[model samples]
Target: MVVDDHPVVRDGVALLLRGEPSLVVVGAAESGRTALERAPGLRPDLVLLDLRLPDMLAPEVVAGLRTGCPQAKVVVFTAHGDHHGVQAALDAGAHGALLKDAAATDLVAALRRVLRGERVSDPRMVPGTAGNQAALARSGLTRREYEVLRLAAQGRTNPEIAESTGLARNTVKTYLQSALHKLGARNRVEAIGKASEAGLL
Candidate 1:
């Protein structure tokens, strides 16, 4: 199965996989909700999941897939390889991750490797560098913290965030402060910037 928001990318990937006699494209979806709704019915052995969907972030989609279709293996297919995104996806149970720029052959090989129960990632996105390692360490933001920070990044006030997340205003503030401290930011602006730089937002 292939899950990507862009029609071009979805069609392109379907075309690429169609050429492989050993592989078959069982389904495709344009949104995270649609993907989750289809997973149980399709029960695909492998899922090529785009990191940024129109309706859901990569981690949310990955977590949903893991819970809804535990038998399916998920590989994050993304354009941005920021540490936070990659780490979050992996932490959410993605078997591997590949950048959108990956060569067709590399993408096929990655799918094969993941099917064989091997974890894979593009070398460039690997957390081998000190900066990447540090970013990975900081990416341990709880789901609530991430939610608050993501909303805060959109210029939402604490009350707005609370209303959106269904949490109390004080709880929203607590999550925001925790996110800021974890991101080493003194203010929401700095936190948003850092989160963007780390690809958390």
Candidate 2:
């Protein structure tokens, strides 16, 4: 199954996959609600889902599909490079995620890998490879630290972050300090730049 808001994308994917002897284009949907409504009935082996559907968020759509069709594998197909969306979708039980710009061979390989009970994430989006891990270790920020940096990247002050996160001012400061140290940044601005480059913001 193909679930994307754009019909051209959907048609392109369906048409592309239809040429493969081992694959079938079972059903297509333009919104999360429609996908959920039709998924169980289609009983597709795999669903190539887009991150930005008109009716629902990516994580919510992933979770809904998991609940609605436990047997089907869900793979996120996104054009954006926001790691938050990728992380959220994975956390919500998506089998894998593929960038929209990925090659045709990579797309087929990702789908097959997911069907075989493997988890695949584009390295550019969620780098979990050895080199990426080494870099991450040098600046290994926790989820809380990432959250703080994300807010800081938007020019939020400690008090603003505290208020937004319901954390105390001192706690926000602590998180910011930790993040800065991990990213080898002496100040908030540098930290934001490093985090953005690392795809953590």
Model number with the top TM-score: 2
lDDT of 1 by residue, 1-201 (tens): 999999999998888887787778899999999999999999999999998788998889999999999999999998765435677788889998889998888888889999999988887653323344455456878766876787787788999777655689999899889988888899999999988899665
User: For residues 1-201, could you state the per-residue lDDT of candidate 2 as single tens digits?
Assistant: 999999999998977787788888899999999999999999988989998888898899889888999899899898864445767788888888889999888888888888899998887664343354444555677767867777788788888778666688999899999999988999998988887788565
- Candidate 1 local accuracy as lDDT? 0.83
Runs with alpha carbons beyond 4 Å of true place in candidate 1: 126-201
Residue 187 lDDT in candidate 1: 95
